[model samples]
Target: MANPQLHLLELNAKTGEVFLRLRKFPNIILTPPRWEDEPLLIPYLNDPRVCDWLSGPPYPYTLQDSKDFLARIKPPADEVIQHLKDADPAAAPIIVGECPVWSIREVRGSEEVFLGGISIIRCENGELMGPNGVDWENKKKREEENNALAVGDPSIIWTIGDWLAPSHHGRGIMTDVIRTLLNDWAVPRMGVRHVWATAFTGNEGSVKVFLKNGFKLVTTHENHVVVKGKMRGLHLLEWQYEG
Candidate 1:
């Protein structure tokens, strides 16, 4: 549920481009990352202030790391790019899978500043159901249980993750980003009725962004995960479309 003051976004398929325009901040947009953004990611992602909060990107983020990440997302991105480029009048361009990412940028004339990244990943109940981030010894049972659930079948379940360049902190940029994603882009395009978000308990700024976007605090999982050899409590939030 986004702030009603902001309206829905249209990802025009016929334009052959994938970008999200913010209603409140017209200059800022979310687009797929390009190869040229390698150096940009290095500086932003390697900053300890940003990487420390993230579990995915490695510390001292390298060019190879960027390449690997970009390569992994290439398939789906290519699909969306192509669809958007040559889509029929009736086609609705979309990128659907376990993880769909976007690069947040502030467009300034011909230049686009890479602020950070965001992802809306489709997840399973088995993963979300667990409080402790632990590996099971019974590998066979784990596989069997996970196999039982189909991919994106119950499309209603999903979660979001995001990180911003340290410079962009305290600007309420991420808050509007989530608002635009839910109320504008993701809701209508993906039919995402339910979204869950989690942040380490002490990360109040991150938690507040989702809160501003209408997510309600569900519960805090104490010592739910280990980051950098330190156990951290996690706050889980839930948002359901009232529409």
Candidate 2:
């Protein structure tokens, strides 16, 4: 059953500010990345403890890398205003990669501090193949398989990914973030039926977060990623909206 209280907040069309309201922490908001966030993002991306688990933004992340990432993930300022004015959450435009990414920030007095990032990518007619063995470089074969399965234009599936600054660890912040995104945004606003996520085997914290948000364990992929010269396993989880 859907939670009646789970609703998306209205975006301020004039200011172009998008936010997800949290019951416990009203000051925390999930919004689009801003130009001022580059500095806050750089240190987190460069942190070995943080970057090792992520698939992109090469080691020793730089300012240029941060700039490029912001550019790629954030939509144009004018487009943001338009989407907010439309008053339809699902109508918000995503930048390149067809993924909607947002910055998790905590409002402190007059300032908002960047805490982390979250994103969801929509994949249509794609199987929940374990993440380990697939050769993503072979785009042709993957496309063929997807096209074959998409004959009738099947329902869209979504994959979620997130990262938080080391400073925010152990605060239960991400757990709430995941829950809010799934219950409020992904399922209700975006209307995604199935949502998937992957976490490295040793990262018990992330696995717990997904489980708390109702994601069931699907499979484990051995040696799914190489972290700091060593191979690591990955656990894939899924959440299906019954409504």
Candidate 3:
């Protein structure tokens, strides 16, 4: 609470970057991944306790993997800024033709700390989930064949994914992150009407994070996906934006 509005004021004073401030935690912000994040990204992600709940990250979470991830998630900062200007502040973070990803960051007076990542991915039609979980294998094939990112297509489904370092868990930081993203950015600016997410049924913390942000449990897929040679039950949650 001591941080006050200065955190945002300081962040916004800088040029050529976008920072999504968490409504409750004034020091916490979300910004596009930077080259400097590579070193920290590896360690935070390598924690099995953190990785087991996630779907995209592979085990070990090497430095090269972090580099490629940072390289690949290219958020159009300029476009987002322009949209903000056009809307006079209430603007969109459209990953229309690019990836909509942001690094979870904590800021002190002069230092910014990388915490984790939050991204809204456009799930392909009829491919949100398969029998064995996320159906990422087919999703990759579609990406490889099409060589194109979703371009605000009406039919495309949007889903969000996020991870927080183990050090920050149980404090409800992720709940605030999702709430800030939806209420401050995704809903008001991007016109995100619906977003879906999945979590292992047993992972009550993850499930609670989404539910706290107004996501409703829609279904549970028993033995939905195979992870580490074992089947895991995954539950689906959906958030419908209400203006």
Candidate 4:
């Protein structure tokens, strides 16, 4: 469970943006995505080196794709938060699982530049099952298997995913960000346990990021996905909270 004191956050009422300070690196912050971030985000999505490993969005990612994606995952309105507060004043204003994405940025002088993005979603049986095209029976079986491990309800298992801009590569920025998110925010604020992640076999950099952040390899799916007409393997990783 989240610390009650950290439940409600201060947000910019006009822009609906909330800023989170990085524990060790106070200059960096995790903020809500804004319309102006399209340019910063789209380039990375369009880059073959980056998008090839990712699952969704057609390559040569367009302005429209960026617009559509942001719209789909936008956080709830202020009125929704107010309603939740009215119902339960003590509850966290924003449910971590409900809001799936946050933009990672660094404060430079008076401006903050978008560096990358981090996301988490609730899954069942360690699988990314969403509202569209779901298999309930399979999900049930997976949940049973997951529950048997004494890891709590599999249906509520939260998975973490991230992507960083190419320009910021090799700086260890993402590794540090992932660690802070898991330790300071996700575990403490979201009460996340058994967080999951997957990386393509060839993507050694991402594999290192997960491993360094304390995720253990659980399984490998050979040729699980096809990208650019070639088969690719995937390694599944998990981080379980003991405390």
TM-score of each: 0.79, 0.77, 0.77, 0.76
Ranking by lDDT: 1, 3, 2, 4
lDDT of 4 at 75: 43
Clash counts per candidate, in order, are 2, 0, 2, 0
Summarize candidate 1's per-residue lDDT along 25-143 as a digit string, tens digits: 88888877677677788887778778777777877789999999887776676664554445443444443333233888898987778898888765322445444543334444444
lDDT of 4: 0.66
Error (Å) of candidate 3 at residue 86 is: 9.3
RMSD for each of the candidates: 5.5, 5.7, 5.7, 5.7
| Model 3: colliding residue pairs | 132-225, 133-224
Error of 2 at 240 (Å): 0.7
Tens digits of lDDT, candidate 4, 183-234: 7666654557767788888888898898988889877777666776778887
lDDT score of residue 183 within candidate 1: 69
Q: Global CA lDDT of candidate 2, please?
A: 0.67
Model 1 root-mean-square deviation: 5.5
Q: Kindly list the per-residue Cα lDDT of model 3 for residues 1-243, writing each as its tens digit.
A: 212211231235665465778889989988867788888988777787788787787777898898887777753644544443354233323332333338888888888888998887664323444455456558666544333434544334567888998888898799999888777666544556667788987899989999898899988878877876668887888887666
